[model samples]
Target: MRISACCFKFLAIIFWICPTAIAVAQSNDAQRHVIVISIDGFASYLVDDPKVPLPTIRRLAREGCVVEGGMTVSDPSVTWPNHTTLVTGMKPGRHGVLANGVLVRGGIGVPVKIDSHRDHSDLVRVPTVADVAHAAGLRTAEVNWPCTRNSKSFDDQFPDVPNALDYTTPRLRQELVKKKLLRDETHASFRNSSIVGLDYVWTEAACHLIRERKPHLMLIHLLNNDATHHKRGAQSQAGYTANAYADMCVSRIIDAIDDAGIREHSTIILVADHGFTVTPKAIRPNVLLREAGLLTVENGQLTQAQVHVVPEGGIGLVYCTNPLKASEQAAEFKKLLTGQEGVADVLLPDRFDEVGFPHPRDYRQVPDAVLVAKDGYAVSGTVTGETLVTTFEEARTSYGSHGFLAKLPKMKAMCILSGAGIRPGTQLQDVHNTAIAPTIATLLGLKYPDADGKPLLNALRTSADAE
Candidate 1:
């Protein structure tokens, strides 16, 4: 969720420097290395121009297959939900990661704290590609990937470093302050939530494992760009500078592979969890509900409520604590919100089934009502704001936002593949995020028919077929 910024700040260290390298032992195994580096908010525009240069990622797009048509990601398009989609090969509804945070089951008359506490595995209901790969005896590793913090499937995991329990802050800070690259760097704009230092943290971990342990399947999540794009629209000068940093991080890992003597034998897949858009307007659904008298606030707290909303970026989950009355409540919402400015779509729980969501639902997280915003607007949870409209002048400085349904024109995510089992210099069309896992599973020599995604074989050279 938005936790990536605030949560990582506490573990702040300079990110400009690269970690010292340890002596690497040569690998004896014949297995291929699949290195996945996810740039959190990367989009196709970053590499579309042939004349413009994006050194590291551009090579990836040219040498590997670029999804020219754009890849459609999971619904709600938040980080965890979409990242979960990649490993599990399922959509949000089927995967059970309905939103960034789960809705509390019986906590209706209470102020909704949707994002406060969460565990990676708490929301996932199925086996991941890594789990299947691990079961097949292939070595797997994960670094800083969300929804994977607790997974036992990886042979080596730095699932959530810096912010998670594993990172010892003082020692890390000292090591970072000593590094040449990061020692001089400063994040003056905390508005974007600096991953400047943490980027090096994950990169070093992944690189070290690549040189030494050599896991067959490695997932490295690098996310500084996500924040910059969040506060600064993709077209902003700030976003470009941030993307350059993220690109350099990728180069480090790529260099690590070459140093491991496995460059030719490795496949480097670059992707993003989702795309972003600029929204200058805000829709405060909770404010509207409060004004409607459905939500009651007292003593600067939520004392009682009939209708409540958990605002995601461009989408919001409207919850009714009583399961029985959910339908009745949703019908009323359609009338109140549908024609309202900036409101595009409002859905009832029963319609969840049609969109690959679980409706007749299970557990505490299902939304009784769902809200989607028109382009240039975002759904905010700020209950104190004006009921219907609020101009977000803050974004005027560096404007961008995401979390609408993925099918919308601007929400397309990134997918680029190169190296082993992949054909070079190709362009792909109609790629879906769901297709990634099964194809990767096939490459890892593993099977996951249970996954909703199919292998995207068009991007593959004959080498993939031989594998």
Candidate 2:
């Protein structure tokens, strides 16, 4: 009888220890490494279509939590602002990155660098997910993320000088060398492409970082898709090719992670800063606004007289010189600009006020009135006469553009979450761009300060017992 009782006690202790051991293992397993990939011009329209030939992306969607329509925030929907929004989960208005270039006030141009290292102190307001992740004692790494030159967000960054005109092959190294932009050359590996070689280099650097550093939080931005779209338009074959190349790069990254034995313990997020649209024509709103005596241009410099028509589209950004005369000028301009071609939506400053946007005093980073152009219709340059009325045949240069309203289905970005704690094959609808930061925070069990996005509980697995 004594021997039998001892045996029973020993069995009970074994059962208790077994469950505790499993729990500890599970907790360790949940400490996953997150890899975030942002393809500059990736669109859901391309991802959802099987004809696009993206096998890896399709597989990721199948194996992860895929948000079919991840909405973006607002327009002129350039790269810098949109990329800022993706990590910070804030709109351009909130983040103070209203556009790719800084707003020129009184003929004094505000300096803007694509590299965050060069930004003014007053610009970056919010802490990004990378910052929050680092705060939580997680390792973070970034490669060629936009607005990184003068930024203090990432623990590791490969900064690139921001120059729209410096896209040539020979100029690539010169920009890096002269600017002293990049942190480590080992993180920079060039991949040959028909268009841009540096884009592949950025991807290779990201792969190297993942293999070497194995950061808990990683953000990689690939720009070739956006570059190709800029040159070939959104609907062109070159755009598709660029998208495929980006997909291939993603596959290589995934393979690298898998080979490192971190595949199952890693959560991969694929996002695009914004979608792209083709510009078929250019409409010069400033021409009409200047004609109405609302604007003054002398010696190639524009001065605000009574009102300013700033282009949120390609060409004009209107600013009101005299606040009291805004209504009268706006009324006149509205009358004259009605039925204008290429005009998508017009928002007055008062409308912005109604929407709880910061007052012009606070939101002065942007223009007084924003004019969004319809698909294929962009704003014209400040050049005189004939340039203003150029048809799509003449002005339809860029293969793709974004920065319209985020409410449009076409403008929506994508969000995919996969790995430990995430429910496989889960589909989330109506996910906002604001929700991303919070989701990432929750996955890492970190607290994000003042983040607007919520943790996606639906994407998480139920308790182990339930599973």
Candidate 3:
């Protein structure tokens, strides 16, 4: 058989172009790798601090892009809400995760309780970064990420919730147990495990996932730093030790990525849910509500109440239980809370949006009003205590807290992006926590136009620029 010159040329071109096109496709897949790490209560101010021994975090910041003033987290700067916002790129109002737990209202005069035992579907209303990535045919994993209970978005998940062990992926759990990284598959075992020990296990699990699953998008959260900051102040010696340990954990994850032979292609982003403040004084708002005849207590138990105030660390969510006298009750409650010591500013329903909160009419999780605590003070839900305020020495439990207004400088969270496609040595100004999801979506070449945030274009290197 005789091959014509034109056919031979076409065949040669096809063979030459196919390999180059395949290599390009492989490179694109490699560049799509992204891993998000959330160190709970890791304040951005500590990033450059000499006292805080965060060598790994510091190295990443130097080698990659770092937000100068830190990432300003969403209002009611708590764990679940902020973390949900991190992945969903939506505020509590939009994402529907208003608290660390879901607020359950039990009719009129009954104090609302935060139920932390809810599933991800009930808590997060919007699609997360994991969901979008998975829908786009990318493998995703979540390790100890809050509000991820029973989430089907990720290929692998170890949710951060009560009874976490019960909800962990069975195959991964068995593997971890067999490796002695996890104890028994009981909630009691998980509960009894030390915070530091859990941190270690979560990191190890993430490392294992990276090496084995090689997920395109992985979310990891560590809780030891947050626990330490709550027990001891953020600047306390114990907190420093916790930070150092977290840095080591980050180093381990990096090593795992390297061991997986994906270090060149993998991008790691470090972020935090919220920062911490040393709250030496605790203000019991429920006591004030009681004294004002808004609520009645019997036998140290809340019996009947016209209104209820749920203390969320640095802020109080004031709820008017009686809809009949809602306005009257709200006005009176505001009057009582206005001049109280340790109370900063009271935000009425109208001002909720200013703080990135949804109106109660829009979302049931929202309270009638918000009570902001003064600096160095925290709102307490203690109603039985006779004293309206408790000093640090008296309370003993008063050490640190978050859940403060997002605008506060103390609530600034950390944001560090490193590795593939990230612009090295880039310094960004203060970024919104919501921007994270969009940035991650951009990194993976996925579309998330509904996100309230815009991608951090300055921190990302374009293909043309890379070339």
For each candidate, give its TM-score against the true structure: 0.85, 0.79, 0.92
Worst lDDT run of 10 residues, candidate 1, spans 15-24
Q: Per-model C-alpha lDDT, please?
A: 0.72, 0.62, 0.85
CA error at residue 467 for candidate 2, angstroms: 2.6
lDDT of 1 by residue, 1-467 (tens): 12232222222222102111111222346467789888888866666634434699888888888898578888878888888888878987666677655555665455445552456556566667776666566778887777765576777765542244342233333443365323422323211334777777668767877887788889888888888898778767888887888888889999899999888889888888888889988777777788899887776455667777777788888887666676788789878898998999997866765456665344356677789888889887666655586776622212577788787757787789999889888888888899888877766666567678888888877754577
Ranking by lDDT: 3, 1, 2
In the order shown, what is each candidate's alpha-carbon RMSD?
Answer: 8.5, 13.0, 11.0
Lowest summed lDDT across 10 adjacent residues in model 2 is found at 108-117
Model 2, 212-304: lDDT tens per residue? 667788888888887887677755777778878888999989987976777777888888877767766677665665676555677755544
Higher-ranked by TM-score: 1 or 3: 3
Q: For model 1, what is the alpha-carbon lDDT of residue 314?
A: 80
**How far is 271's C-alpha from truth in model 1 (Å)?**
0.5
Q: Which ranges of candidate 1 are over 4 A from the true structure?
A: 1-28, 49-53, 167-193, 299-303, 393-398, 463-467
Residue 5 miss distance in model 1 (angstroms): 32
Name the lDDT of candidate 2: 0.62
Best by TM-score: 3
State the lDDT at 347 in candidate 1.
79
